[model samples]
Every structure is written in C-alpha cells, then in structure tokens.
Target: MFKNIAKDEMNLQDKPMSRFVNFNEWIFEIKTIRAIRVSDYGQPYSAMANINIHGESAFVDSLMTKSEQEFARIDAKVISEFLRQLGIEQVQFERFKNNQPRLHSVSLASEPHKEHKAKLVSVG
Candidate 1:
C-alpha cells in the first residue's frame, strides 16, 4: 500500500486500464499504473486509485524503503494476485498488468527568489 508523500507524480502512457475493487469497506477505482523512477538507480511502480469514500483519491504501491534504501520488483503475476485479493477479476487484473508501463521524466521549472536579510534579536 502507498503512503502519503510529497513527491512528483509519475507520467504514464495513454489509455490506461481502469478497474474497480472493494478494499477496507471502500470502493476503489484504479485509474492508472505507472513505473516511477524516483531515484537514479531504481524504478518504483504504483497504482493510482480513486476511493468512493467521500470522493477521495490515493496511490497504492508495493515498495520497501528503509534507511534511504529503496527497492521493489513488481510484475504481472504479483499485480494480478494483489488485485485478485482485492476482489478484482482475473481478467481485469491481467489487463492491468498487460498494460504497458510507460516511464517518463517529470521536471519542474525553478523560480528565482530574492535574498532577504535577517536581523538577530536577543530574547531575555
């Protein structure tokens, strides 16, 4: 499962598969799957799902990050099994797995900022 983080969103290919599954008493509609490259070495794959609980959305990923070390190996069978356990059909999961995981680079332009001088005040 994915945890809330402040990071860039992965870019995926067009026409990704969409499926619905029930999890934790909420209906989740998985919208897209993307193979993310957060670091310069490894690739992180994630599923973007929309929860029907008050129209909330969240991401789900199978990742192991500890002490600045991260690794993940997600394949079709694994994804299929996960979705299968989540009440999604085999066919739908297979389709989701078969969908090409397009990896793209995401970049943001840096905005220039002015330097401000700070005054030191002693608190007694």
Candidate 2:
C-alpha cells in the first residue's frame, strides 16, 4: 500500500534504475550478439544476449530497442545456441523480456541512452 509515492516512483520497486544497486543485483553486460528478432514496422529488436561478466548466462528476451545499426541484426536461433558458440553452456536463461532492456542501466539524471552510445562511437 505505497499510495503516498508517485506512480513513477512506485514503478521503481519492481524495475530499478540500475546505476544504483545492491551487491546481489544483476546488471547485464551484453558483449556481442546477433539477433532474435529484427525491426519489423513496430518491433525494435530482440536478441539472445549472453552476459559474460561476473557470471555467464544467456537471456532469451534481451529486448534492445536501440537503432544500433541501420537495420537490426536478425541472424540468431536461440539464447543457448548463441552462448554455445562462446563455449558457455549449462547456464540458465533469465528470459528478461522488455521493449527497452537498456533502461536498467540508465543514469539518475535521466540522460538518454542514445547519448551514452554516442560517446562510445568513433566519428572518424
């Protein structure tokens, strides 16, 4: 019965803004990925993303809605199959599905994710 808090604040209970977190909290570090679903009219993207940090695991529903490329990469089968390529088997799939999984790692200032990506990209 958290009625005193704003609705947006209430949403934070289940979905946190991961820049701040506990030691047990998980932050996905997707090194490289192909794709589970490409951009199709309304769809942004979905990938069988594998986390190769802290612990090794594959997530079936890494819904990355960023326009990382001119077109989305849709050349993957399943999360496990993708992880198998990296010799990372015997891990469980979290199946963390969302239209914007990157939101989990956004800053407290509410900076746009694209701005964060811009810094990592070379313009030369």
Measured by TM-score, the strongest candidate is: 2
Mind giving the per-residue lDDT tens digits that candidate 1 earns over 1-124?
A: 2233221233222222335545565665544444333444355523322212111122333322343542333333343333333333322211122455432211111211122222222323
Give the best candidate by lDDT. 2
Q: Which parts of model 1 are misplaced by more than 4 Å?
A: 1-28, 35-74, 92-124
RMSD of each: 20.4, 17.9
In Å, residue 123's CA in model 1 sits off its true spot by 42
**TM-score, model 1 to reference:** 0.21
Q: What's the TM-score of every candidate structure?
A: 0.21, 0.26
Candidate 2 C-alpha lDDT tens digits along 3-111: 1333343222332212222233443343444443443645655333434322233433343444553212222223333344333333332333353232222111231
What's the residue-level lDDT of 76 in candidate 2? 26
The CA lDDT of each predicted structure is 0.31, 0.32
Clashing pairs for model 2 are none
